[model samples]
Target: MLPPRLNDGGRTDLDLATLRRATFGLKLGAGVTLISLAIVEKLANPEMARAMLEQEPLLNLLAPFGVSADAFAVVAGSVELLLGLLVISGALPQVVAILTAVPFTATLALFGATEFLGHLPLYGVLLSFLVLGSLEETSHSLSGLRRRAGVPTH
Candidate 1:
């Protein structure tokens, strides 16, 4: 299928359908990872959460708020869990993607180059989500193709 033309009357060969599928995969992957990490830090291994809070950057960030490390950990975990659920559910994905990006960007800034390099793949996915917006139902799937071709399904 020929790619659609842009509003500016410019033409390109980008396969939007394939791009959307790739974005969905990225979103699902990030969501699952976030949920799993949240569960592990908050429940499966509380000690790890405590140790994470002891990191210099986190300590500095939390110092002004007078919030206890444990409390911060709980709140952070809860936020991650909620964000993961929202992302996976495809609820306001563009907005959720931005929301997710804020903290991720902050963490990258806080930790500097090492983290920035390590999280390059995640950054790409987040950028793709921001640019692509929400995933819409497309008629390119097998079921849709079959329906379009007047094929009977049992």
Candidate 2:
């Protein structure tokens, strides 16, 4: 059940263009926050960091990225957090979301591809799909940013 707002801006009509920006923006923020937090914990304490990354499937794939488990956790986490906040607060969410996601998506997809090529398994593919599918959230945030930036909606 969806919660109704009392303000009453009757029959919500969502513009597809606006929806795309909003979705993209939110996804970027969430992803960045998640990654950044993980990296922070790993950096603060090596042992605890090791233990944390051990549970994430990404640990096994870290070697190809040239970052050690501890380093990978810390780096990935910090980067994600920073990126997430930027996406959420950027002045041009629509443009930023599209710009950032392109590289972000490529990095993940490349890693996934490397995993596949290295004979890892199906997990990489699944992770890639998950990462790619979340772009809609990025779009949402981007839409808000776009409106805030005075970008015209279709």
Candidate 3:
């Protein structure tokens, strides 16, 4: 059932343009944070990063894949750097958001509830980008869906 607040007058009161701008800001911030962490923790202080990754069950999880914590750190860091750049550049943001979610989901699965709560904000950001699609578009897939259902996107 549609929420009464959202279903008022067969149109949403939400301002999608503002929502899009907010999502972009969040995506950019997440990208910068990823870049900084990659450089400082993984690329610059590799030994310390490896030590951190070597913690118990996480280390055990990597064993079956034949990936040492050191190698994983380097590779993961490189991926983070690349994804961060892509995100900041606004290149295929939806794809980047999905890719970013993989690691977040894996971490949540590995570490459980605490990590889930910690990452909720990030999850919301990614979800917003995904739902909103390209900021440049006047109407996105979700809007199309709404239109099909005879709902006003605006």
Candidate 4:
């Protein structure tokens, strides 16, 4: 019981539209939650972040470079906060997703399998958003604003 315009080639374009909107809404909610969590974990509990960094075995390599673990924690937390905002913005999903994965990749390498397994689901979710979100659907970001203002996406 579907209209012809929505039932092309035996596929329900209407159903696909519903699915897309549902998934997008889920991603948006997830992005907001992530932003809030990152702020709390990284910014509010910076000592905890530094302690976690101290637990990383690979910090040994950076010690010779005089890298202060506390400072690194602050920088990392700031970057995480920014990336969390980017995720919520939904601009250039592919680029944002890839950037968001970088810290986790470092964490996996530095902290080993436990860390990787803990964050694997996050990576998977980001990948899913990147793969499923179409560029045309990203009209709520700064880039989108620029586009609406007659500026180039670049």
Which scores greater on lDDT, model 3 or model 4?
A: 3
Stretches > 4 Å off in candidate 2: 1-36, 55-60, 90-154
In terms of lDDT, model 2 sits at 0.50
- Candidate lDDT (C-alpha), each: 0.65, 0.50, 0.68, 0.65
Clashing pairs in 1: none
**Between candidates 1 and 2, which one is better according to lDDT?**
1
Please list all clashing residue pairs in model 4, or write none if there are none: none
lDDT of 2 by residue, 10-29 (tens): 43445556545544544454
Residues 14-92 of candidate 4: C-alpha lDDT, one tens digit per residue = 4544544655565666677667767776677877767776676464335567867766666666777778777766677
Better of 1 and 3 by lDDT: 3
1-154: candidate 3 lDDT, tens digit per residue: 2223545566544465554455456657877987988889888888877777766447335557898777777887898798777766655657877998888788876678998998887788677667656543423422222234675555
Off by over 4 Å in 1: 1-23, 57-63, 134-154
Error of model 2, residue 28, in angstroms: 11
List all candidate RMSDs to the true structure.
7.9, 9.6, 7.4, 6.1
Which regions of candidate 3 fall more than 4 Å away from where they truly are?
1-23, 57-66, 134-154
- Where is model 2 poorest over a 10-residue stretch in terms of lDDT? 120-129
Q: With candidate 3 superimposed using the best TM-score fit, by how many Å does residue 100's alpha carbon deviate from the native?
A: 0.8
- lDDT tens string, model 1, 1-154? 3355676576655465654555467667888988997888765676777787776546335657887777777777888888887766655656877898777788776688998897687677566665555323322221122133565433
